[model samples]
Target: QADVLARATTWRDRLGADTPRVAIATDIEQAATLELLAGVMLAGGSVVAERPAPTTARWQRWAAERVTTVVGDPDVARGAPDAVTVLDLDGSTSPRQV
Candidate 1:
């Protein structure tokens, strides 16, 4: 847990993101996923775990959250605002465990 937190802090610092609102589609039950979520929270950021289909409702919800970053496949962030940071971690490092 401590290690995860440290890594999170490092990543957050490197990204220069303060209190970011991150959009992600991941299962919260997984150890790695939970660790990442914890890190985001600990860094004073927020997470959107579900990726609703691109629609008026989705845009409205995302607008309400003021999401700053979307992390996932390229297609997942296709229509996000230009102000939002899109990180295509698809097929990237998949840490199976914490």
Candidate 2:
């Protein structure tokens, strides 16, 4: 609970009321995702996620349900307008943005 409190305080300080709805799309499993999710919520944001899917449609549904802001691999940071922010944790390279 201490960790949660600290994270929430930090989030309130950084974001104020501009809490973001986030989604993480990656191969990362649920257990591994909790820490990150907690961080987001603590910051007054929300998170939606699922295992990497074979189709974008599936991911799209999840994004819609959670109102995600970003979607990408698990190693790098990617930005999205509607979600909290995406991070790729596997250290993989993303395609060119253009």
Candidate 3:
């Protein structure tokens, strides 16, 4: 867990901002979400785990939460504003490359 948190710190730092709000949208079968959630939280960041097809209300909630980043499916990532960084975690266990 500590190791995962360390990696999360790296990801948080890599974001290059004081952003502490991250939104996760992915399938339940994926284990990467666990790592991502832990990492973000360990870095003192908040997380919003959303399903792939989120409703307008949910999206509004995300906006209200001040989501600074979206880490998961590409389509869901597109839901974020242009200023928000979208980290695609598709076809991989780690989020290093994308």
Candidate 4:
């Protein structure tokens, strides 16, 4: 899990220290979900789990929870507003903007 933590640390840094909550919106089977959640907690941040659902519902939950950083599916991340940062865990080369 060190590798996961390391990656998560990198992501957390990008998210910034003031970020209070990290949202997870990926399938449970995805290893990155657990790793990112653990990493965020270790960094003294809270976590909000977003159920796998429609893009609108997921984004709504994120907005309602005031999610600072999102770590999971890129598709859902696309729906996040410009205020939220998205860390895509699908191993894609291109990064998701807002």
Considering every candidate listed, which one attains the maximal TM-score? 4
Clashes of 2: 8
Candidate 3 global lDDT:
0.63
The residue-by-residue lDDT of candidate 3 on 55-97, one tens digit each, is: 4665577888888777776565444566767776542322332
Worst lDDT run of 10 residues, candidate 1, spans: 89-98
Best by lDDT: 4
Pitting candidate 2 against candidate 3, the one with the higher TM-score is: 3
lDDT tens per residue, model 2, 1-98: 67656654554344334676655665446543445556566667766555555666554565467553443463323233333444343212334232
Q: Clashing residue pairs, candidate 2?
A: 68-83, 69-83, 74-88, 74-89, 74-90, 75-88, 75-89, 76-88
Alpha-carbon lDDT of model 4: 0.67
- For residue 41, model 4's alpha carbon misses the true position, in angstroms, by 1.0
Residue 47 displacement (Å), model 2: 1.4
lDDT for model 1, on a 0 to 1 scale?
A: 0.60
Worst 10 residues of 3 by lDDT: 89-98
Instruction: Tell me which residue pairs clash in candidate 1.
Output: none
lDDT of 4 at 69: 76
- Per-residue lDDT of 19 in model 4: 50
Cα displacement (angstroms), candidate 2, residue 29, comes to 3.4
What are the models' TM-scores?
A: 0.64, 0.43, 0.64, 0.65
